[model samples]
Structures are given as C-alpha cells and as structure tokens.
Target: MHVFEGLEQRIQFMVLEVAKQVDETLRVLISPDEANIEKVTSRDDYIDNFKSVIENACFSRLHGQSHLDKAGIDFIRAVNIISNNLERISDFSVDIARQVQYLSDQRFLDQFEYRPFFRQILGALDIVVRALFHRDLSLALRICRAEFILDKLYKHNFDKIITRLQTGKEAQNLITTLFIFRYLERMGDSLLNIGEAVIFSVVGEKLKINQYQALRDSLDSLGVDLPLREVDFESIWGTRSGCRIGKVSGDNKGDSTGVIFKEGKHKKIFQEKINIHEWETILPGLTPKVFGFQESRGNASILLEFLTGCTFQEIVFNEDKEFFEDAFFLVQETAAMIWQKTLKAQPVPCSFIAQLSKRIEDVFVTHPEFNTPQVQFCNLMIPSTSELLEQLQQVELEVTAPFTVFIHGDYNSNNILYNQKEQRIHYIDVHRSTHGDYVQDVSVFLVSNFRLPIFDRIVRCKLNQVSLHYLHFARQFAQEYHDTTFEIRLALGLIRSFITSTRFELNEEFAGSMFIRGVYLMELVLAHQGRPWEAFRLPDRILRYRYY
Candidate 1:
C-alpha cells in the first residue's frame, strides 16, 4: 500500500480497535464478565501504542512529502486528531472494565440502561471511520448529531445518580458508577470533537456549525441587511458565566452596525428580554439597544447593540496608577448613579430575601457535594445547607425603602459596559435582572469584583479597596433611603450567590477560595444573628479568611 493509504488504514484500524473496547465494555457493564474485563484492560497498552504510531506516521509523511500542500497537511492532522480521540475512547473503556473487574457482585445496576449507549458509540465509530476515509460531510454531520443524543443520555443517567444520592443508597457503588458514566459521556465529547475536525477539514474554515446556523437563522429572522453567509460569526468567551455569546457585525454601504448575540435556555433568554425592557423604561441608555430576540429548538438568542468601550474592570485594573485611581472613583460614582435610579423605581413584587430563600433551596439540591466535610474545601468551616438556611431566616430583611426598586441581579463588572468618552454604562447579559433589594444588586456587584481571577497581591489589594468603596457608596444610598438592612442582607446575598456558584466552577484553588469566603460570611451572619445590621462589615480581603 502507498504511504498515504497506509496512514488512512492505520486510522481505521485504531478506531476499529476502539470499537472493540467499547463492545467489551458493554459486556462488562451488563454482567461482570471477567474475560471482557481482561480483554479491554490489557489492550490499553496497544491502544496507546497505536496512537503514537499513527501520530508519528502523520508527521513522517509530512516530512517525507515536502511537496505536500496545506490541504494534504490538514488531512494528516485531522487523522491524527481522530486517532488521539479513538485512543481516549479505549482508555475510558478500560477504566470502565477495571471498575467491573473490581466489582464484588456478578451484576451491576443498569439504572441508566447503558448497554444501548455502547452500541450507539460503537456505531458512531463506524461512521467516523467512513467519514474520515471519504471526507463525507454527511457522515460527519451524523456523528455530530450523535453527540447531542449522547448528551441527553448522559444527563438522564446523571440525574439518576443524583436521585440515588437523595435516596441515601450505597455511596461507594454509586460514586464509582458515576465516574464510569462520566467517562462514557466524555468519550462522547471526544467523538464530537473528532466529527467537528472532519467538518473543519471539509469546509476549510472554522465555525461551530450549530451556532453558526442559529445565528444565521437569527439574522434572517430579523431581516438584517447583512448577507447570511458573509456575516462574520466569532465565538466570544464568557470565562465567568455559562452563556454562549457571540459578536456579529457587517457593512451596509460602509456603515457598520455591531450586535452582540447571546444564546442560552429559554427561561434565561426570556428573563433577559424582560430585564432589557425594564432598563429601557426605567434606566434608558443604561443598556444596549436590544434589536430582536429569537427562540427555537429549546434554545434562544438575542441581538443587541454592541457598545464600544473597555469594561470597568479593564479601567480599574489598568497599570497606570493614576488611571486606576481615577477609574476607581468613576466606577463607584457609576454604581451610585445606577443604584439611585432603582431606589425610586417600582420593585418586581418579589422581596429580595424571598428570592434568596428560593436560591438557597436550589443551592442545597444542586450542590449537595458540599454537604460532607470530606469534600475538603477551605479550612474555614461552613454549616450544613439546612442549618445555613435556618440561620439566614433569622435575619430581618424588611428595609424602609419607600417601595421596591428594579435591581440588576448580576451587576458584575464584566456584565456592565462603560463608555469613557460617552461617560455612560451599559448592561448586557441581564438574565438575572429583577426587582429586589438594592442590597442584593449591591452585594452581587461587590462579590463579582471580588471573585475576579486576579492574583497579583497589589492588584487584589486595590480591587478589594475599590469594592469597599463601592460598598460604602451603596451604604450611603441605603442611609439616604433610610434602608437599614444593607449590611446583613449583603452578607446573606453573598452567601446565596457564592455558595450556589460553587457548582458552576471546577477549579479547586479558585473555587475553594470562594467557598472559604462564603463560609466566612455564613459564620458571620450566624454569629451576629439578631444584632444591629450596620454593625457588621464586609471583609477587605478574601484571602484574609485563609488564616482561619
């Protein structure tokens, strides 16, 4: 066989070998078959070697075929990616087999009905091989679609595991099985990436096909002047939030209009609409001019004005000391400006504490991992969810505001846009915007600044200083409004937002550090329970609690 043909055949052989692993894993999953365990486990070495061989073959071909074009190189690299993903599939299969081999029982619980998934994945492998060989975009599309199906199955099985946890079933067995399911689910993701690589190779350009389709449909529905295909769609990263955000802009007769596109669940998108309209009415020009909204396929996207300016965070963190000092004052003044607008507006009829109580309930249900001390967060201790709820209830939230005020539920620096030239602030990603305690927005703003991923001691110190100034700004608003609950309620809001946030973040050091702050605030709320609300103080530094 020719060198190129040999490489292609090797890629096929690698996937087929991975198919065997998944096939054997199914037998082990259904029944503790020792031979299936042995077969899958022993082949891990071979699979690893196969990956190395395929990778080296691709590179060697590139080196030998000096006349190869970029397309030829891309084909080689795509095959390499596929081989790597297939090897991972084998590794996961071996992990599953090892779990089964160590099982003391002859039968494992099939609560997830995982046998069909094995068949599905094996089928996916077959299709992937064909797609790679022929560069068949249709087969690649099918593989991508299979990932969605696999995700649904994974969620169904994950919820089953959580339900088992609620029932107080066998912990060790359930945890191990949970890890196995995680492996299977990750295999699905790796396969998805492989399929995407196929599409990338075929298209000769990069775009998340699903989102590109959604964005195109969105611009079409809006009847925007930009041509559907020509509209540049670039994925924007949300490092701190779970929103699939993008920026789409185009030229119409040399007049370009930029719009931000955000996609998320139906409810979140719906809330964003309400919040945007609320700001439009009460605090006009304080948010981007929302162009339109669309919902379909259990997801929603919105297009709005993409304001041009640095984030308040960028201004605050800029290296110029004078700029930082000036920006610090300006940020606080802006906070005061926005807080005052809501101080007189009609509230959403939901009390902040009542809303907080519901969120605390969600925290308990979603983040039950924090229930056990063995979870090992920071050294600072936290109360059980139940106990924390009880302590939270003891605080008095009835403040003497003339009435409720519209509050930005997520007032983080990243969410708020600043135009230094225009001296205006615009809010985006306002899904959580609701009418609640001014203190709720205030507390969120404070913690949002606090939780930023900055580690420089001096920068952190300055950021904390700015946060304290912002809080003092909020307190001034509170004192003027005759609202007495700012201090304690801020603590409660921090606890609710921070502890619940643990589920979204996976970084141990960052998450653990945040957990410590949450626990510290929780303990303070419990200690000063029934005391004067103003007597408590928000900490100047998050790391200070680390010494405890």
Candidate 2:
C-alpha cells in the first residue's frame, strides 16, 4: 500500500478502536458494576489521546506538501467526520459512566428495576458502532431507523419512573432512575449523530433524501437495501412536526417489516376509510404504493414503497441544457396532468378573499395595537400601497371557473419528479392536494419558479428579459398541456394577493419581503413594457417582506 493507503488503513483502524471502546462503555453502563464502570471511566484519557494523535496526523498530511487524490480527500473528510462523532460518543459514554457511578454511590442503581431500557440503549449503541466501522449505511440507517422504537422505550420507562415518583412515598431513587433513563436517551441521540455522519459520508448530502422516492435513488446506486421496518411515532426520527422522514428495507422478498402499532390523537381523529377512499378514488394513480398506515404511540405514520426518481428542482438546476428542453417539457407535462387531476377530484371553490379576511383578523387580534388609526390606515394610505391594492382589487377571481379538479395546494417545482431511464415524469409531495381554482394552481406554480433566482444569481442569466421567456414558456405550456388562455394576469394576481397578505404585518419594514421586491421588479418590467405606473406600486406594508 502507498503512504495515503497506509494512512487510510490507520484511520479505519482508529475508527474501529473507538467503536470498540463505545461498545465497552455501553456494556458497563447497562450493568453498572463498579469495577467495569471505573475501567471505562479510566479509559477516557486513552480515547482523548487517540483523537489527538489522529488530529496531528491529519494536520501532518496537510503540511507535508503531499497532494491527495479525490478518493484520498474524500476518505480524509469521511474519517475526520467519523472521528469527531466517535469523540462525542466517547464523551457521552464517560458521562453515562459518571452518572452510573453516582447512582451506585447513593445505592440508587439497585432501586431502579428496569433493565430492558438499558438493553434498548445498548442495542442502539451497538448498531451505531458497527455502522461507523463497517460504513454499513444499512446498519447506520437501522440505528437512525430504530430511533422510534428506542424513543418509545424511553417514554415507557420514563412514565414508569414518573409514576413511581408521584405515587410512592420514598421515591428519591426514582429521580436517579429518571436521570439514568435520560442518559440512555442521550446515548441514543449520540447514536443518531453517528448515523447522520455515516449517511453524510455515504451519500455526500444530508437530509435532502427524506421522501421515499429520493431515498430509493440514493440507495439503489449504492446497491444497498434499507427497508422500512415499522413506523414508530416515538422514534427519534418520528416527531410529528417538521419533516417526517425515516428509512425502510430495500429487500422485500426476504423479511417483511413488522407491523408498527400507533395509539395517538391522529388515529382517533383520522378516518382510515376516508384516507383509503381518498387514495383510491381521488388520486387513483397518484398515491404512493401504500405499505401500510399505523398509529405509533400518539402519532400516525404511513410507510410506502420507496420511489426511484429525481426532483424537478434537482433536474432543472443540475443537469446540462442539452437535456434542458426534454426536462422542461416533462415538468410542463407533469404539472399539466396534476393540475387536470386536481380539477376533476375537488371541484369546490374556496374564497381567497374570505381566507385573507380571516388572516387579517387574526393578525389584528394578535397585535391589538395594530388597530390604532395610525397603524390601520397608515400604510394603506400611502400612495404606493393604496395604488397597488387598488389595481389588485380590479381583478376578481370568480370561484366560478369551469374547471373544478384537484389542485396541488403547493404546486411548486420541488414536487415534480423525473425518471431518466424511462424518460418519465411523476408528481409527488401530494399531502396538500385539494379542490380549488385552476388559476390558483397555475398562478402559484408560476410564482414559485421565481423564488429560486438561480438563473439570475448563479448562471448569470439575464432575468430582465426572463419574464418574456417565462410568459412564452407558460403560454406554450398552457397550450401543450390543456389549451388554456395565454395571460400573465392570473399569475400577477396571485403575486399581488401574496404580497398583500404577507406585507400587512411587515408594513413597518417595507424593504424585507421578496414578494415586495418582486412587485417592484414587476413595476420596472411593466415600466419597460409601457404599463401604468399604478400597476407597479405595492400595497401597504407589502414591501416589508422584501427586506432588501
């Protein structure tokens, strides 16, 4: 082996050593025998020294004037991240050891009678350690992937401890158990960090591959199979808010995933029949292949077959223009299909004015002082704002448009998917689909594309004339997709409404909102296009959303 090869081997050895130490510490934590805990605590310096040596070696390589190959650089980066994660895991192990020692000193360790919780933490640690050393993303995924189970385990144990503390007369030991359980949960968290590091090392990206389809592509190329075992709402990755992302197995023929049990508010309120009916009827072909839906703990989660494709945003921005025409046409076609399906499924007309009115009311109630004469009429009274709002009011959306199909509530470029080999298009991120105005989908789609500014910022494309291109393409899309009328008016109306709703609260800060800036940009373009000056001014406080 060459010198870099030798260094790579050495780094791998160090990672495995740290993983071994982690395993040892976890074992001591589970049993908490005085001799074993003391031994693990005593080895803290050795872990620290190991880390110091690796850091010096990395620095030495950087200083030695030895040029590193792509693989070497990638390896060095991976090792560095892995080394840092291991160091943190070791620190956490030491913390667990100290907590265990304290519990033993007070004779509190014996009073707490739950060993299964420790076992769960130990399992999580073991999985994480193997994941890092072997770079087994499947194992790493199982570690991140098992967060929900361990989360429930912690919660169950926590409840037991809490119940004991509340009802029992002498419960100081329960408090210690709570702390110990907390350490165990923290151990799981450290394990999650290791999993994330492994994923970053493997995929070269972070949490971008959450949707099933994206994950499938990422793993398929690696020839790895990470099956979704079960949906655990309490799993570390199974939180209700934010992104609900998890992993599943790729191999389906061998071992099927276990049934996940969820008992939560979502199950009580959500109608499975309705969800199933909606999937079957409204989105016949749109729903992802449902593996199953279950209520775990107090959260409802569903597992579906992983998708294998790329996002429209990724395709448009990343791929070369030699493929641009085909990619753009695919996006246009996909959006058209989704738009048509949306129209047929849900033909109900929602009053945007009523919605805006309620939102305005909520804002006033939240900030009662905004009702003051100076504030209420202040920005609206401004010529620019009043003039802009007046132009917007001239355009009235009749909930009466003939097309009444299901509309993707947030139809943006991000939701469109592309398959290269099949030369096919798929629409995803369909959770927010609903029945609404055709223009609502159309206008929102057009406006969303304006957000990236990728053409303007990175590629040095002239955007002043980009509107012409946008208008031209949109018209072409309308004809190609469904032969709709050619007009930027609906898109402009959506932009105007978006500006009004967002800027009302931001009135004091007019130069903040991008919508406001976009309106300003519209004005500059309209000025160039020989449109009225009144068309360009933004509604009151609407400029606030555009900080710049």
Candidate 3:
C-alpha cells in the first residue's frame, strides 16, 4: 500500500480492535448473570495502549517525511480523528463498566429490561464500526440516522422506568432501575457520538439535527426503525415521596414497553409537564421541559430536560448580530413574563446575602492588590467596594424609593435560553428566584453585561464604566421594561449593590475595580438625563442607544 493507504489500513485495524472491545464491554454491562465487569475494566489498558501507539506512529510519519503528499496529510488527519473517537469510546466503555459494577450489588437487573438496552448499544456500535471499517456510505448514513432514535429511546425508557418505580412498593428495585437507566442511556449516547464521527468522515458534512431526522425518515420507510418513541408517565408504576405506595395495577402495568423501531412505528404523545402539574410555571417559550418535581425531595427541583441553546455571552462576544438580536429579544420577553406572571413581593433569603458576602471576601481578601498580573477566575470581574460605594448609594436611593419586584438571582446572560427556530425566549434555572430589591437581577445582569464586548463597547463610550458593555445593555433593557418603575429602581439598585461589593486584589497593578465602572455608568446615566452629569460627552458606541 502507498503511505496514505498504509495509514488508512492501520487506522482501520485499530477501529476494529476498539469496536471489538466496545462490543464485549456492552455485553458485560448488560449481562446481569455474569460478573464480567472486572474483565471489561482490565481490557481498557489495551485500548489506551493502541491509542498511544497510533499517536506515536502518526508523529513518526510526519517527522520522517520532509513534505507529505496532500492525500497523506488528509489520511493522517482522518486517522487522528478516528483515534480520538476510539479513545472517547474506550473512556465511555470504562465508565459503563464501573457503573455496571456498582449496579451488580443492587437489584438493577430485576427492574430494567437489559435486552433493548443492549440492542441500543449494539446498534450504535454497528454504525461506528461500519463507518470506520468499510467506509460504506450507507452504513455512515445509518449511523448518522441513529442519534435521535437513541435519544427518544432513552427518554422513553427513563420515563417508563421512573413510572414503574413510582408505585414505590420496591424502593430497592426503584433505586436499582435508576442506576441501570442512567448508565444504559449514557452508554447509548457514546455509541451515537461514534456514529456521528463516522458520518462526518464519509460525507464531509456535519449533520444538523434536521438532516439526521431526514436520514432517519428515509431509513424508516425502508422498514428500519432508526429512532423510536416512548410511553407515558402513568404507564409505569411509581410513588411520590409522601403518597402511599401501591402495586402496578394489573391493568396499567402492561403498558407498551419502549422499543427501538425497525420501521413500523406509531406516535404516542405524552403530556408534557405544562399540560398538568403546578410548580414555578414559567410561561412557555424557549425553555427546557420540566419532567416532574419531587415535593418532599427537600430542594424543589424541576426535572428539566436538557437544552441546546448557547448563552447570550457566547452570541454577543462572537459578534453574530443575528444571534444577538434573538438573544436581546429573548431576554426582553423573559423579563416581561417574570414581571407579569411570576414576580411577587416576598422576603429575601438570608443565605443569599451571606453567600454574596463570602464571594466578595474570597475575591478581595487574599488578592488584596489589583496590580497582580494573573487572571483570577475566567468568569467574574470585581472592583474595590470603598471606591464604588458613593455612586452606588445614589443609585440605591432610586431603588429603595418603593418599587421592588422579583429578582432572578444570578441574572447573567448565561441563564437565559433562546430558541432560534421557535423564535422564543425562555427563563431557566429558576431555583434561585428571590423576591428581593429588583435591582439584584438588574445589577447582576448589567454588570455581567460588562463581561460581554459588544455591549461593553457601548458602555465604555457612554459611561467609561469598568463593564461598559454591560451598562449599555442594561440601559437598553431598562428602557424596554418601561412599564415598571420597579425595573428602573432595580436597575439602579443593582448598580449600587455592584458598587458595594466591588473590591480589587491587594495589588494596584492587576486591574481597575468594578466600583470604578459603576461610578462611570452612574455618572453617564445622570449625564444622559441632563441631571448632574449632563455635561459629560456620551461616547460614540453609547450613542447607539441615545434617547430620541
């Protein structure tokens, strides 16, 4: 074989070896009767060794050749990608093995049906193997097609198992089922990832979710059930924490078990939590689906399905104007909903203040100087408290002037979820909701905006603030929520709180504090309104949001 061809062969051989190990690991994980967990654990060493050998071999080839042929370079890159995928597979397999060992001592096998679980793993593995070994376009297509099927299957199985356990008669059995469900679903995902890699190699096109769906549909028409649907919440016997436990009704227990469809399928829609169940109801938009809640579980956790939307921080910083518009609108809508439906006058938690104080202490006490040439945390940028407090007190006067609404604690851009397709904005992670001075959310959101550039540029020009970007976004946000004086107060209060909390490290050389930023912004707002700082010239960027 030629150099490039020889490298392809080597990668193909490695893929086959990894695939074999994966297959064994899946079987060992599913086979409750056998104690093969240790056997699978021991096999990971071989996979790791194979990966290291391939890395070295690839490196050697690059070093030995003065100028590699284009085809040879392409082949090497492909081999590297394949090697990385194989290593990930190995890591996942080891995790599965460990999970299986944990489940071994429990009643995992008794509640969860391992047959379908094993099949999902096997199907995922088959797709990856075909992509690597044969380079068959059809096989690559099949692998790409399996991701959604697997996702739906996992959801179905998880819901079904949870429902079965809810009847609560077999607490031990339920615990076992939980572990099995979590592991099987996780392993299935690893296999799906492998399939995605295979498809990427063959088509040189990254499959969007919609593309995968089309492929899945095509395969389904040919009688291949690529992705499957699951059963309802009531179908499985389950128990609530305080509710009395009961046996699965002979009538309800025989609900159709979730299946990996081969082509013929039926659509069964389960009622999402919005249809029933009452908790902290965020008006439906671009939010994660709350699966259910455990009232007596102490901490009120809404079982939220995973979300894929990127944070506003990512969008704004990337300078994607299209995404930024969507993010801006989404935040606006979410704020509106909170004001209209959720915001209520309530007592603030003592714990929140304590935590905030601790955060300030940790940020400033040890690093008492701003001059240190080290980046502290990747996230926060704090300023010295004493320097920023006077301006903040002026803003707080506006906040405490009788309008306090609910605060979305930690109201940074990261907490909002935007759906581009649905054109929706949803509030998420509401576990920290507090009825504090509305300024808490406004301050966090505004100051946090300083962390993003597009907004910061505007603030820097307008306010010459530390987080100039944030001040700009906050000002616009404040204008948008014009219906409530509470919002303006909240915004002002937020700045004040930010000022009080601002503290730099012990060194002056490190960076300017947020207190400085707050002072700049406070002055800008006053200047813009023709109040005290009216003579101050608004910077060009801040003019983007100039009052009409």
Candidate 4:
C-alpha cells in the first residue's frame, strides 16, 4: 500500500505538471506571447524528467524484493501506462506551442473553433488522478468520451481548412493549422489510452471502452444491480478465439453466482449466441444457459451461466481413476445421445483437407521445419508437405460420411466439462457446433487428448488409454450404422487436427511429435488408397506417445 501510495502521488504530480503545460500552450495559441511560448517549451523537460521518475518507481515496485498482490501489480501497470500517455500529452502541447509560430497572423487561427479542444483535453486531464486512484468507472468513461468530442472538433476544423485550401490562399498557414489540430487530436488518442488503462486498474483486466459498455449493457439486461466497480473480472487466457472471455462475479462472494462474459466481433459472438440456442434445443442441459446478449455497432457480448464443473482435461490429470472413469463414461454417453438424436441420413464429404488447407500456412508460420520437401528414399519418392496435402485431398474425395450428426465442432478436452456432483457432462465454446460428420469430433477429441503437453509417463498412459477407448467406441458406432469409410475419414480429420494444432504449440519436441504423427497418418491413408476404404485401419501406435 505504501509503494502504491507513493506511485499514485508521483502520478498526481505528473498530471498537474502536464495540465500546466496544456494550459500554458493554450494561452500561447490564443495570444502569441514569446514568454508564454518559452514557458510551455521549457517546462516539457521537467515533465519528461518526472515521467522517468514515475516509470522507474513503477518498475521498481513491480520487480523489487517486495512481493505485491495481483491488484498491486495491475495498479502499477496502469500507473505506468497513464504516466507514459501523460508525457505524450505534454510533448503534444509543446508541439502545438511550436506550431503557433507558423501562424503568420494570430487571428488566422480565430476562424477555427480551437477553444473546445483545449476545454475537453483540460477537463479530461483534470479527472485522470481521481478516476485512476478512486477506481471510478463513471469518471473513466467520461475521460474516454472526451476523445470523441475532440475528434469531432478536429474534423470540423479539418473540413474548414480543406475548404480554405481550395481558395489557394494562405496554404502554408492552413497546413500548419492542420498540424496543430492533428497534434490536439493525438492528445485525445493518448487520453483514450489513459482512460482504458484506468479501467484496467479497476477491473484488473484490459477491456476496451466498447467492451466495457457491452458488459454493462449485458449485466443491465439481466437486471443485475451491481456496479461495474463491484464486479470482479478474471480473464480466461489461452483462448485462440480472439474473444475477451472472463468470469464475472459480484463483490459479495458468498451470494454471487458468477457468469462467463464473452465479447468479440459481432459476427462471431452473434453466431455463438445462435449456436447456444440451437444447442439448447438439441440437448436441454448440454450447453450453458445464456443470461444476456447485447450487440453494438460492430461487436457483441454475451453473459453465460458459469457451469460448475471440472473439464475433461482436469479429470485426466487431477482426478482419481474412479472419477476419471465416471467422467469418461459420461462423455461417451453424452456423445452417443447427441449423435443418435441428431443423426441425419445424408452423405457429407469430408472437409478435413479443406480445413487443413485453410490453416496450413498458420502451421508453417509456427513450425517451418514441419514443411518437408519431396525427398527420395531408396528409389521411393517421399512427398513434400504440399504433395502430401495433394494426395490427401484426392483421397478425401473418395471418403464421405454415410450419415451426419450434430457435433461439437471444437471438441477439445478442455471444452468438455464434467460436473462430478451432478454426474453431468456439458460443452463450452460451441460456436463451431453444427450438423457435420461425427468423425470430425472424434478426431479432434483424440488429438486434443493426445497433444496435451503433459509428458509424465503415467499421465500420458491415461491419455492414450482414453483416446484408444474413444476410438474403439466410435468405431463400433460406425459399424452399427454401416459407415464403411469412418476409419479413413477419421484419419484425415486427425491429420488436420494434429498439424493445425501445432500452431498453438511452442514446445518443439511435442509439436514435432504431433507433426510427425499427422504425416504418418497421411502416408498410411495414401498407402491404402484404391483399396477397400474399410480395410484402411488406424494403428493404435500412431496415437500412443512412446517414451523414447
């Protein structure tokens, strides 16, 4: 607390100094006084020096011997961002003052409405300390709104300058005036950053103004009376969906039933909302209940009931054998129920190759070494990455699912949750859910279990066992439904899942294993091409991690 207090005081001092710089710059702009111009320019050095002091203090508190809590670290981070932006504002003020010299006539600037720019900037700056220190969402929102006002003022003046330029008179003065307004506009940009940083400090998560508003609207829709400041937000990281997902709960931990808040592009979030509703219709309790949904200009947010359970990933790594078996059995039962209930008698071409093509570049971006070139081994031509893809594409053309089933598109282990007490299974991140070949989910589920970075022999053995068990179960389902190409189609799906998954993996050895397995599967599928598709068998060795 002492360290934070010290840093806050330093920031407050910096804010006051920067405010003085802006006020002095405004005076110089209104009535060009050589003394005032010098004051604004000279004081910039002091502001820079103060910024360095505050920055060093922040870093010291963060990396020093003293251990600080999460809130403390977030506060320090916000302070650092705020101080840096404040310094930028001061530099912009000095730049604006310098531009005043370019005005041939001081009244030349009088034609444009510049006074409101200063008024907005100064008003926003006035509340930076209070908004940040007091953790006031209202004040922070006010600060962010100032940027819009400044932008509008800048646009008006810009239009006027362009009109005056068309007259082909005083072009230089007009351009110079535009530079001053541009610098003013930049100050607004910095203020927006400062306001968001303050919000980050309060929420302890980096949320844009739009996202904050979306969250507010979503909570309001649910008739939740809690203030934004009272909501605790914990971000769920490691999500590749590009959505801002977090768990939101009220300050009263005992009484609060938390909800998952997700905000992203309007299309993605809206699609997810629709998918959730569809899933609810297919299986009543399979997906989280949507508490609220709101769409803005181009983004949307949804509030989902936070399902209480441990993910399948947790069950494998943490739970005992009995618990793991119960969870796995529930997963199998749930998969069977969903597939059987939604089975449609329609032939669907396997899209694994197409899916792989879309994401292959991303894979090479992460693991370029996996992109093999054609090579000759004992008069045998080994296909390159592209050639392998070509061969697989041709092979995939011959294999199609006999029937389609509604499936969880992204069937990763972590996406499946098992509520132990209730003995129930639930799925999350179901935006990709749709009526598709059930092999797609099977392959993803297998690779998801296999590619988990857990390297312990016992844990890996469990993962392998689970993967094999599910593979056999799926195979039996295929046989019962007279689906002949399930094995071949699943191989293609595995190849796609295995290779594309490497993009998210950084561990070279582990990623290399997955890449090799994918290539091996592709080769096997190609080797058995032109033969009865049902004869193409997926060797269990390909899925097992051999401890070498």
The lDDT leader among the candidates is 4
Return the lDDT, model 1, position 57: 93
Which of the numbered candidates is closest to the native, going by highest TM-score?
4
Give the alpha carbon lDDT tens digit for every residue of 389-474 in model 2.
33433432322344555655555555555677677665544455555565565555544444332333443232222323444555
The Cα RMSD in angstroms, rounded to one decimal, for candidate 3 relative to the true structure is 22.0
Return the lDDT, model 1, position 187. Answer: 86
lDDT tens digits by residue: candidate 4, 464-496 = 999999999999999988889888888899999
1-548, model 3: which lDDT tens digit per residue? Answer: 36655556666676676667667765765573345766566777877887777888888888899788654554455566667766776666666666654553444564445555555556655555445544344454445444444544556566777787788765565555566556555554555555555544443445443445354334323221122221111111011111122223223667432211111111112122333222244454444554444433221223444444565545554456677666676676566556556545443322222333345443333223322232446685443353333334453343232333555655665566566776766554443454555456756665544432222444333323323544455456545544234334433444444443333111222124444443455555554443432132334242122221
Residue pairs in collision within model 1: none
TM-scores for all candidates?
A: 0.59, 0.40, 0.36, 0.60
Model 1 clash tally, residue pairs: 0
- The models' CA-based lDDT, in order, is 0.65, 0.49, 0.48, 0.82
Q: Tell me how candidate 2 scores on lDDT.
A: 0.49
Candidate 3 stretches with Cα past 4 Å from truth are 4-6, 29-35, 62-72, 104-107, 127-130, 169-176, 205-211, 214-548
Clashes of each: 0, 33, 42, 0
After superposition on all C-alphas, the RMSD of every candidate to the true structure, in Å, is 11.4, 17.9, 22.0, 15.9
Q: Global lDDT for candidate 1?
A: 0.65
Q: Please give the range of 10 consecutive residues that has the lowest summed lDDT in model 3.
A: 232-241
Name the 10 consecutive residues with the lowest summed lDDT in model 4: 225-234
